[model samples]
Target: MKQYNIAIEGLDNGSFQQQGCDTVLRAALRAGIGFPYECNSGGCGSCKYEVVSGEVENLWPEAPAVTERDRRKGRLLACQCRATSDLVIRMRPQPEAVPVIAPRRMPARLLEVREVTHDLREFRFGTETPASFLPGQYAMFALPGVSSPRAYSMSNTASGGREWHVQVRRVPNGKATEVLFEKLRPGDELEIDGPYGLAYLREDAPRDIVCVAGGSGLAPMVSIARGASQAGLLKDRHLHFFYGARTPRDVCGESFLRELPEFGERIHYHPVVSMPGEGENAWRGETGFVHELLRRRMAERMSECEFYFAGPPPMTNALQEMLMLEHRVPFAQIHFDRFF
Candidate 1:
């Protein structure tokens, strides 16, 4: 691996900086610099950065992240470029608190596979590399023959580490997950590249947390809640995680969670169902659209707590607007991964 020195001109950081050998976006994200990116794939063109001088090796030439015109304009995908020489890249910095997990194209064996719900599958991978990530963040899991990777949130948040735990939802006709569901068994191997994404728990912020998730979205929320419980963090803060499901059978681990000592009061689990079955009676929990439940609950104490919304994009985006415009939670206090 050859060393590369990158001098980011016009940036406030400094002049000639030694980049050594690293992918451009991976290096920047590792430094806690907020590099603007979306899919982190060449598909979205979100991580496109201009080359001020020198040259770089495009790791993925046909990355969808950048357009042919931009590629001709010297605009290459940050996620695709590697520091091959003393290059000068004029790109934005990723924000602090964004832990960088350098991707490795390695083989991991399927350790355990469980169904969280009808549409969700909890797949565990045993990897030689350790996963270090913040609670509430996500990563991209790649498999062989798949042109693009699927994004899922980490179930364990261990920074200064590698990759640990994650939860993923199965899409209909989704090749990766479909194969993972049927053919993938313990000891089966597949290719993975990730430890990407942030938008996790803002521990530095002083406020209670209102986490709204659906289906597998509960993975990160569960991880963060468990972390907070273990560390006795946010003792004064209350955690309200409302998981949405169609019926009780569609749900997974609420009983297990309620058994945890710290979860009795400090944490509240509200499982809302859209339609109760015929035999299932005595339903006391909230019902209807999950966001409406959030609206009613958050509307009262909206001023006191911070909001972290996940799950599907439509729900998150609509809730974001509701929290900011309707409930009055400040923008700075609301943290969500709309894309993740």
Candidate 2:
């Protein structure tokens, strides 16, 4: 394997080595450079940068994060490009963007797979090294036969252990889910690189915590809630957990959260169904979307708490609009990594 030098145009210490076939963002992050990025899958456009004077190979030219205007401007997503030669690039670097735990590729073995819902499954993997990360950070898995890696949030609290768990929903005709659901089996081997994403539990904040999740987005929210319990944050502060699904069958989280040692009155679980079918007449919990439930239940104290949410773009976007635009919540108070 060969290495290429990556020099940032303006910063004095913005130099790092890009290992063979590694994306620019990964290399910078591995080198402890705080290059801005969120959703390392190239869906958020946060890792876009300019090629100052170097040759690079674009991995996903048609990535939704990169627009025609961005391509015309020669801006490339650092997570989607690899340096072909020694190169200089330019991107805004924020000190806070530095990863809490630097990511490195490691081998993991599938330990177990449990059914969570009709379309969702919980996967447990055992890594050769301890899988350490913040409670809400995500890991990128390199599945066999997949051209690009897929990101999944860790569902378990960080315990400096060798076990990792993620809940994945089967997407219709999704290449990654097809492999994850059909081909992979217990004892299978795969590569995982992560501890990425900026959305994690803020233990220092004195305010109550609110987590909104839908579909597969439940993974990180569960981790956040568990972490809060483990860290004793739930002892004094309330954690409002709102989860939404299409039908009663898709609803999960009660069993998962109840397994936590800190499950108590301080933690409130609100499960809602958006479109229950005719057969789901027995459904008696909250109805409508999760964001609507959040707004309805916590509308008065929206600004008094910290919000963390993840879901499909529509759900996340709706929550963002309602929280930031409607309720006047500060941008810093809400945390999430967009997953397209």
Q: Which numbered prediction scores highest in TM-score against the true structure?
A: 2
- Provide backbone clash counts, one per model: 16, 0
- Measured with C-alpha atoms, the lDDT of residue 271 in candidate 2 is 93
Q: Give each model a TM-score.
A: 0.77, 0.97
List the candidate 1 regions with Cα displacement exceeding 4 Å. 1-7, 12-23, 38-48, 51-77, 80-87, 97-107, 157-163, 190-194, 246-249, 274-285
Model 1 lDDT tens row, 39-118:
56565566778888887788788754556688688888876787767777787665642455544455677788766667
Candidate 1 positional error at 44, Å: 7.2
For residues 1-340, could you state the per-residue lDDT of candidate 2 as single tens digits?
9899999998898899999768999999999999999899989999999999979999889999989999899989999999999999988889989988898899999999999899999999999888888988999999999999889999997687898899999989999999989999999999998889899999998899999999899999999999998898987889988999988889998887897665668888899998766754757878898898998999999999999998999999999999989999999899999988
Model 2 CA deviation exceeding 4 Å by range: 279-282
In model 1, state the lDDT of residue 201.
Answer: 71
lDDT of 2 at 221: 96
- The 0-to-1 C-alpha lDDT of every candidate, in the order given, reads 0.68, 0.91
